[model samples]
Target chain A: ANDDCSKMLLNRCSGCIAVRKSLNSRNISKLLHSCPHRCDHHKIIVEAEDKYKSEVRKSFICNKKILLTPRRRQLRIES
Target chain B: MFRGQRGWFCGSVGQDLRQLWVAEGGTVCDVQAADFLFSCDASHPDTLRIYQSLDYIEDNATVFHAYYLYAVANAEMKTSVALGHFILPPASVQKEIRRKVGGFIWEQDKYFQIEKHDEL
Candidate 1:
């Protein structure tokens, strides 16, 4: 939604995209430690973790200045 | 057969696939002088000495996989672009050019065109 904070926002700062990796790892660990009597929660945890990671990666790339640099092969010729 | 003093054999296919084809040689001459060209079958060796010489020439020459056929001589001269060579599949395999797999089809060429471009 438009309400989502843009990482590269010039005036209103949200957070650094690079820090999401550690944030995600911390989240998964917290979820695992809080699980008391495990039932079908394993599948739910795995699905949630995958979704979180995908979102983190997508936003990280989007908020950055650029992704991949453009390049072409050099042509060498002789007479 | 090529008769010009400055000659070049080029493989027009992609660099990744050019290695599979044999080299060709020949000669070209025209009153335009600049239009004069020569070519030979570089892939077919005339003699042991000539075969080695052709290989040495091709190895030393710069190869280009241009949209159109391109030629360069001695590494320092200007490169020339031309459409002299023609590569195509043979008539026998024309029917088998493309085959149906599970849900996909594949095409293969039977004939290869190998030609040399003369100095411009």
Candidate 2:
């Protein structure tokens, strides 16, 4: 029984990670509401959401097009 | 099961996990020579592309995402996969590690506990 419980826990962990990956880029709200797992693992979902938001912010800040727009305008004015 | 295994740690959190892996009797090596690739940021384009490319992944190598371990530490969930792959540790061992680690990525007690709600 102990072994069985352990296996179950392992499977749950595996499933949770799979769910997290699947929902990686999707809406965090969807993960909270529509996730099939229906498991009480909101903490994981929240962390994923936080990570996603930070990544998006980082990418936006690093985007070359956005960063170069002012430089390009300056070059045009100089020309 | 990790004994004698050659593992590679990628990303910031990878270093901590690498330390733990070494403590577990695992050897640290280069990515190409590793049996286990522990990646923290699987969402990165290069990491994602490499994971998506079946040919890039070695036949015998297993990729474990750091998020999975973090989840496990938080008692959230578990796995190994294209994105979700994980190395399974026995529940008792996992619990012990969790207790020792006390929050994998972030500091313990920093995360606010939300009330359990069936509806989100």
Candidate 3:
């Protein structure tokens, strides 16, 4: 998988392809390996990962139920 | 006339533009080495910065956005069809492209005006 990733990077694969491949991988350490240079493809994958993490954080925050029942009720009611 | 020019294309339109560039005798090359950089979206920060630095008349390097190319091609096609000329001369095509670029610059100024208005 690391060899495949290196080959794809060398071929200058499109951002979408790179993002898909990176997202499909179960292990980041293995996929990223020791890439010599931070090329455009790597930058795209990093950006996508950051975006995904942020989105998950946001959703978790939104779903959190605090003890402020009245405030939470009002917020839900308003929406 | 792109007889000896080196060109590079960005975005999906690059493939189409590559064919056109080759047809016009231009060689496709790496972006850094290209005399002509054609992009579908010139609004990308890096491309925008390069475009802002270019002197359209004085600089040998030129960046052509896809909108300008479409406008030029559309006008050329219409003119050729109306005149029953299957193909227009290279000199005439060059002159038309220059005129279209001038118009495109004006359109870009209008875009800036709209952006400023939105900010205000």
lDDT (10s digit) by residue, model 1, range B32-103:
121111112223222112222221122211111222122322113222212211111112222232221110
Runs of candidate 3 exceeding 4 Å displacement: A1-79, B45-61, B67-120
Second chain only: TM-score per model? Answer: 0.18, 0.46, 0.44
The TM-score values for the models, in the order shown, are 0.15, 0.34, 0.30
lDDT tens readout by residue for model 2, A1-79: 3453344345443334444323321122333344466433333433343344345445546664234233212211211
Candidate 3 lDDT over residue span B1-120, tens digit each = 356766566543445545656765767766555655665454554444433321211122244453333333445442221110011112223244334322223133322222211111
Which candidate's lDDT is highest? 2
lDDT score for residue B34 of model 3? 63
lDDT of 2: 0.40
**Poorest 10 consecutive residues by lDDT, candidate 1 chain B:** B100-109
Candidate 1, residue A10: the lDDT equals: 23
lDDT (tens digit, per residue) of candidate 2 on B1-120: 246666566553444555556665768766555555666454544344434332221122334554443443344332232133243222333344445432232222232222222221
**Prediction 2 TM-score vs. true:** 0.34
Here the TM-score of candidate 3's chain B is 0.44
The complex in candidate 3 yields a DockQ of 0.01
